[model samples]
Target: MIVVVEGISAAGKTTWCHQNAAQFLIKESYPEKRPDRQAGPGEAARIWTDWNAKRWSDAVAMERAQGVAVCDTDPLKLHFIWAMWQIGEVAESHWTAQLKFTRQALQDQRLGFADHYLFKKIDPDVAQAQKDHDAARSRPNFDLHLRLHASLVVWYETIEKVLSGRLNWELSETLPAAEHTPNPYRYDVSVFDRFIQMLPRPRR
Candidate 1:
């Protein structure tokens, strides 16, 4: 089974991943040169879609070897663009482009939903305290992450409707166990559409 741990910055995802799934963890990553704000959403979403697809592939391969593979973030990260748009930090075009590319990737089997997810929640004050005490990592977007916190819940809640029993709202004290079931929606576009349809329609 593939397990994804998703949360805002400084929410102990890395700490939990390293502690629990160290040998089979696929950590979150950023592009070497993230596109600038001036870049069109078309090109930017394609690049990001590929990055997330690669992570999904890695998780699939690792799960074959170890029974469990842990991802620091959801590989199907279209929620990012939507969440950014919800915060008014990006144009709706970005979310649309990302949704298109991400849905296509799902249809192509380049990315798929995980077998389980830990949508860990954290208080803003607790996150700030963690950021202050941890000198090693700098969360320059801590404020932005805090802003996205509520919006992210909506994102995951929408996912739970499509995925049903596969998600846990909190991280477990120990690695949660999941059995490997034949994933019918691993490459199903209808499942992708259902997930999107559950959310508010994107800008026309």
Candidate 2:
């Protein structure tokens, strides 16, 4: 099974992945080259889709070899953009462009929904304390992550509703094993459209 593990900063997701999924883990990465700073929304969307598709492909290869593969984050990360848009951090054009590009990637099978998702939900105060104590990694965006956490949870709730039984909404101390749940809508473009449509509309 392809399992995605996601959490905000200091949520212990990376630590859990390191301990349990070293063999079958696909670490998140950006494209080798950055897009132009002045690129338009469509151009940016195309670039991000390609990058995410590569990650999904890597996860598939790992799962084929090892019987399971764990990803540090969802490769089809449309939620980040939508969540940011939800809070008015970005303009709607960006979300629209990304939806167009990512849905095409799904239709092409370059990107598909994972068989399972594990989320690490933590108390904000505890997460803040953990962030303060972690000296090795400098989480400059920790505050931003805290702000985005609620919106992120809401995003995945919609996903869980749309693709039922595939998401474990909370993570425990140990990684949960995923069953071979046949995802009928894994590559369905209409499901992608529905998922996007279920998102909270961006505020004016």
Candidate 3:
């Protein structure tokens, strides 16, 4: 089962996936693992090329190996992210680079994940609770924060459409609630239990 935990930054997806899934495959999870480079690094392409290659490769290997792989984010989400950046007075070039990196990753099958759970209704109080739990965790990207919340209803609907049309997969924006605290990792066990209940069995 490929279970992807997707949401805005600092939405407790990483925490939730760790608790619920057998394996986790977020981008930062294996920062030391690098793949063979497909594109050359130069002045303009240095940062973008490296980021995409590593992310794409890691995704491919992890998905192939794990039974219950939990991806913290999906590159498809990049479209919204980059758009947010552009609308929030970010450098046009940077936003373009984000889209380019995501496009390359998707084309190479690195960003292709199945069984996504798109978290919705990221309450500010819930976000604050998570922030209090980790000092190193910075605030969500400002542009993304403003853009996603302002248009989440539309964004969520659009994502569902894309999932069906391009990936032939279903998408939902809800998950089992955390029993205590905002840690998503705590919810992984419940997710696995629910999966088991859905399986078929041999005749008695």
Poorest stretch of ten by lDDT in candidate 3: 178-187
TM-score of 3: 0.56
- Best-matching candidate per lDDT: 1
List the candidates ranked by TM-score, beginning with the highest: 1, 2, 3
Who wins the TM-score comparison? 1
CA lDDT for candidate 3:
0.46
Error in Å for residue 174 of model 2 = 4.3
Error of 1 at 80 (Å): 0.9
TM-score of each: 0.94, 0.93, 0.56
Q: How displaced is residue 94 in candidate 3, in Å? A: 3.1
Cα deviation of 17, candidate 2, in Å: 0.6
lDDT ranking of the models: 1, 2, 3
All candidates: CA RMSD in angstroms?
Answer: 1.9, 1.7, 13.6
CA lDDT of each candidate?
A: 0.86, 0.85, 0.46
Global lDDT of model 1: 0.86
* Higher-TM-score candidate of 2 and 3: 2
